[model samples]
Target: MAGPGGRMMMGQSGERSMDFKGSGRRLLRQLLPEKAALWVMVAAGVGSVALSVAGPWILGKATDLVFAGVVGREMPDGLSREEAVEGLRERGDGGLADMLSAVDFTPGRGIDFTTVGGVLLVALAVFAAAGLLMLVSTRASTRVINRTMYRMREEVQAKLARLPLSYFDQARRGEVLSRATNDIDNISQTMQQSMGQLINSLLTIVGVLAMMFWISPLLALVALVTVPLSVAVAARVGKLSQPQFVRQWQSTGRLNAHIEEMYSGHTLVKVFGRQGQAAQEFAEQNEALYEAGFRAQFGSGVMQPLMYFVSNLNYVLVAVVGGLRVASGTLTIGEVQAFIQYSRQFSMPLTQVASMANLVQSGVASAERIFDLLDAEEQAPDPVRGARPGQARGAVALERVSFRYDPLKPLIEDLSLAVEPGQKVAIVGPTGAGKTTLVNLLMRFYEVTGGRITLDGVDAAAMSRDDLRAGIGMVLQDTWLFGGTIAENIAYGASREVTREEIEAAARAAHADRFVRTLPDGYDTVVDDEGAAVSAGEKQLITIARAFLSDPAILVLDEATSSVDTRTEVLIQKAMARLAHGRTSFVIAHRLSTIRDADVILVMENGALVEQGTHEELLPAGGAYARLYAAQFAQAVAEVD
Candidate 1:
C-alpha cells in the first residue's frame, strides 16, 4: 500500500499488517546500550517483588497465631490443644476436631498479642524494604529509558543526514517530521510510564504463582484456569487494535502535512479565495484522525474490564475450593486465607498487563515507523580519499551526461557543455526543461546516470560532495533564512570567519547595503525563519548577498533576480556581471531580458539541447531560442498595453 517514494496512501495501515512480536523484540533491542542499568533494574525488581510476595505469607502466620490463641481461650480450663481435639472427636465433631488439630493453643491462655505483634512487625519491615527496592528499580528504569530515547533521536538525525536529497524531494514533510518528533515522544512517554510497572507486574506474577503452589497445589491449579482465557482476550483485542493505532498515527501525519502546507501558503490560499476549500480539506483529515484514534482506544479499552471480569471468576473459584479444603481439614484457616491472597496477586498482574495493552501497542507501532526511517536506503558512501579541484580554477565540463529522476522518464540525456574560467553561460528554457536539472547535475545533488562531469579536469563524482560544493556559490530563487540577524545570515555563506567590514562589503556588492541601513537595527535586525521582517525583494537580495560573500570560483544564480523590481534587477545584473568577470558562472533565468549580455546562451527543450550560440547568433538562426524570445517579447508588449 506504500505509494511511490515510500509515502503511504490512505488505508495502507489496514493493508499492511504489523509484526507486533517482531517489533516488540526490536524495540527492546534498542535498549542494549543501557544493558548494565537494565540488569540493575531487573535485580531491584526481583528483590522488590520477592519481599512483597513474602508479606502475605508472613501475615498468614500472624493470623494463625491469633486464631490459635482465640481457640485456646474458648476451651475448658486445664485442657491442652490435644485434650480439646480429643474432646471434640468424642462429641462426634470429627471434621471440626480435625480442623482444630492443626491449631496450636493452650486451653487457659487468651490471645497471644506478643507473638502476633512480632509477626506484624516483621510484615511491616518486609513491606518497607520492598518499597525501597521498588524505588531503586523505578530510578534505574528511568535512566535506561531516557538514555535510550536520546540515542534513538541522535541515530534518527544521523540517518537523515546520510539519506540522499532525492528521498527528501519525494517524501512528505509531515511523515518525516512526525516520525522525528511525535512518534519518538510517544515511545518515550510509553516507556517512562510502563517499563518499571510492566517489569514488576511480570515478576509479581511469577513470585505469586510460586507461593500459591507452595501453599496448595490444588488451589494453584484452580487459580490458573482462567489465565488462558485472559490471554486469549488480550491477544484478540490487541490484534484488532494494533492496526488502528498505526492508522491513527498515519492520520496524524497526514493531518500535520495539510496544516503545514496551508499555514505556509496561507497567503496563496487567500489570494485565490479558496479558504473554504482548505477548511473543508482540514475537516476531512481531522475527522479521519478522530475516527482512527477513537477506534484504537475503544478496542484496547475493552481489555481491562474484560480481564477484570475473568479475574473475578478466578477469585470466586479459588475461594469456594479453598473453603472446602479448610472444612475438610486439608488446609487450616490461615493457610486458606494466604492461598486466596496469592490467587488475587496472580490475577492482578495479568489484569495490569492486559490494561496496558494500548500503551504497549502504540509505542511499538511508533517504534516500527522509526525503524523504517532508520533502515531507509542511504546515499553511497564518500570515497576514503576523494579528489579535490586543483586550486579551484573552475574550468567545468559535462561529457556525454545522462540523468533522470525516474529511470523510465529521462530528463536530461547525452548533454555536454564546456565553460572556461571567466566566461558566463546563460541557460534559457521553459518550465520542465532541463535547465535547473543541468545545474543540479553540476552541483552533484544528483549523480549522473552515465558519462561524467569534471571540475578543472577532475571528475566531480570522484570528489567528496563537500569538497565539490565548497568552491561553488548558489543563490536559489526560493531563499532560505534561518532565525538570526541579517549579518549572521550573510556570514553563513563564508567558509571562515568574517569581519564587519567584509559583511558590509558583500551586501554592497549585491546592492543590499543601502536598504539594510534604512532599517531600525540595520544589519542587526532580527528576522524569523519566514524572513517576515524583510520584503520579498529584500530577502532575495540578502540571499544574493550571501552568495556574494562566499567569493567562490563558480557562481550559480537560478532565477535569483525573479523577485526584484526592474531597477533592483538591473542593479543586481550589474553587480553579478562584475562578480562573474573572473569566475565560471551559470545563470538560469526565465526573463530573457536579464541575460542578453551573457557571453553565450544555451537553449534547452524536452531534456535536450536544441540550440546553442551567442544571443545574436542564435536569434538570427531563428531556432528554439528565437521562438522563446518572440513569445516573451509579445507578452511584454501586451503587459505594457
Candidate 2:
C-alpha cells in the first residue's frame, strides 16, 4: 500500500490502538539484536537519573542538618547524637572542621556559610556527573540505532535480490522501491529518536516516583493521581493515530506507484495524446494522500499538548497538599521543595513519552510491511544435483508437455516435439500461438503443468536451473542493456573474465563493431538508461554479441531481427549463421524469409505444429504451410514485376 509522496497513514482501521503487546515486543526484539551497546547505554541512563534524583534529596537533607546544628544549636530533630555523628562521618574530612566551627547559636540561628558552600559544591558535582552520563548514553544509544538501521537496509536489499520474478510481476515496482527505501528510512528515523528518549523517559519516571514516595507517601499518592488518567488518554490517542499512520503510508505507496507508472510510460502517453487524463489521475491520487496524511499527523500532534495540560493539573494538586503539610510543621520546607521538584520530574517524562508515541506507531506500521515482504514464498528450488552439459549433444525433447499460466486456460496443450542434436529448428507462428512460451518452458522460466521436457535424455526439471540455463544462449525480441560501456554489455553473460580482444571479437561477429567504434568512446563509452541513447537495432546487436560471447551449446533467437531494418536484419542473419554453425538452435520469427534456410521448419497454429518439414517438403504437402508460402511468395513476385 502507498500513501502520498511525504505523508502516510497507518492502516484501514484508523481507530485501532497501537498493539503494544504484539508490535512493540517484536520491534524491540528486532532492534535489540544489533544493540550490543544499548544495554550499557541503558545502565548509564539509569545511573544518570539516579544521580539527578539523589542530588536534590541529598542537598535538601544536608541543608536541614546544618540548620539544626547551627540555628537550633543541636542535632537535627529526627537524628540522635549517634545519627548526627554518623552524618558528620559520611560528609568526610573535606572541610568538616570549618563547617562545624562556623555554625552560630548565640545571637541569630542560621547555617554556617562554609557548610552551605560545601553542600552546594557537592550538589553541583552530582548534577554535572548526571549530565555527563546522559550525554554518553545518548551518544551510544544513537550509534546503536544507526547501526541497526544500516543492517535493516542491507537485509531488505538482499531480500529484494532473492525475491522471485513472479512477485515483481504482481507488485508495482515503485511500491516495492518505496518500502525498501523511503519506509525503511522512516523506520530508522523513528528508532534513532525514540529509543534514547524512551529509555531516558522510563528511567526518569521510575527514579522520580521512587524519590517522591520516599520523601512522603501521602504527597506521592497525590502526585500519581494523574498518571493513570494520562496513560488512558495517551492509549486512546495512540490507538486512533495508528490506523491513520498506516493509511498515510499506504496512500504514499500508491502515489509513488502512480507517478512511476506515468513517468515510465510518459512517451506512450504523449504519443496517445493522453497527458490531460494522466494529470487528472495523478491529481486525484494526490488528493486522497493529502486527506490521509492530515488526519494521521493532526491526531498524533494533539497528544503532547493534552499530556502537558494533565501534568500541570497534577502539579497544582501536589503543591496545595504539600504546602499545607509544611505549614502544619509536619514537613520541612526543604522536603516540600524536593517533593515538588520530584513531581515535575515524574510528569515531564510522561509528557515526553506521549510525544514519542507517533514515531513508535509509524515504525511499527513500517515493520509490519517489511515483514510481510520477507515472508513471501521464494522461487521453486532446483532439484538436479551436479547437473552439467550432458554429452554436449544439444538434443531437446518435449514429451506430452502441457502448460498454463492460469489453470482454466491452457496456452500449450499436450505439445510434443523433438529437435536432434545440431539441428537448426525454426518455429513460425502468428501472435499468441505460444512461440515465446515454448522457449520460456525450455529455459525453465515457468514449470510445465503436465508431461516433461528432456535435454540429452535427462529430465529438464531435474537439471540445475543454472546448469540448464548456462547451456542455452538467448537473444530476445526486446533487448535490455545495462548502464555500462559497450564492452561491458558484450561480456555480460561470459562465465570467466573476458578480455577486450574477446569482447571486440564477439561484437564483430554480431556486426555491432562498426557502430560501436564510431561512438565517442568506442567500446568504452557508457550507455544511458536502458541504452535509450542507442538505436533499437544497436541494442539488439549488443544482446546478440553477449549471447555469442557465452557460446552455449544451444541458441534461441526469439524475434531477434523483428525491430531492425531489412539491411541490418540481413547482417544479423549472417551473424546468426556463424553463431549457430555447430550448435542446436531454435529460431522464432514473424518474417518467413528469415527461417526459409532452416533445416526443419515447424509451422505452428493455435499452439500445435500444423506442418513440419524442410522448405521443399512443406510446399508439396499443400497443407497450412503450403498455403502460407503460396500467399507470401505470390505477393513477393507481384511486387517484383
For this target, which candidate reaches the highest TM-score against the unseen true structure? 1
- Prediction 2 TM-score vs. true: 0.85
Task: Give each model a TM-score.
Answer: 0.96, 0.85
Task: Give Cα-based local distance difference scores for all models.
Answer: 0.88, 0.80
Which pairs clash in the backbone of model 1? none
RMSD of 1: 2.1
Give a tens-digit lDDT track for model 2, residues 1-641: 22223222323333344454576676677767755688779888988989998887877767665665464454556544444444666778424423333333322334666777888888999999999999989888888878877887888887776665556766787788778877888888888888888989999989998988888999999998998999998999988888888877777877888899889899999999999999998998798889888987888889999999999999899999987776554676668778888888899989999989888888888777676566566667877475555486899999999987666787788778889999999888777788888888898877888999999888888888888988999988878888888898889979889999999999999899999999999999999766876788888888889998998989998766766788888877788888888999999867677777888988887877677888888878898777777777898899899
Candidate 1 per-residue lDDT, tens place, 1-641, comes to 34346655332334577778898999999999999999999999999999999999999999888888888888998877888889999999998988888777788788889889999999999999999999999999999999999999999999998887777776777768888999999999999988899999999999999999899999999998999999999999999999999888888878887888898999999999999999999999999999999999999999999999999999999999998888887888889888888888898989999989999999998898888788777787788899986688889998999998887898888988888887789999989888988998898877899999999999998999888898999977888999999999999999999999999999998889998999999999999999999987788788888888788899898776666788877776777676677888999978888888788798999988888888889888988999999999999999999
Most accurate candidate by lDDT = 1
lDDT of 1 at 250: 80
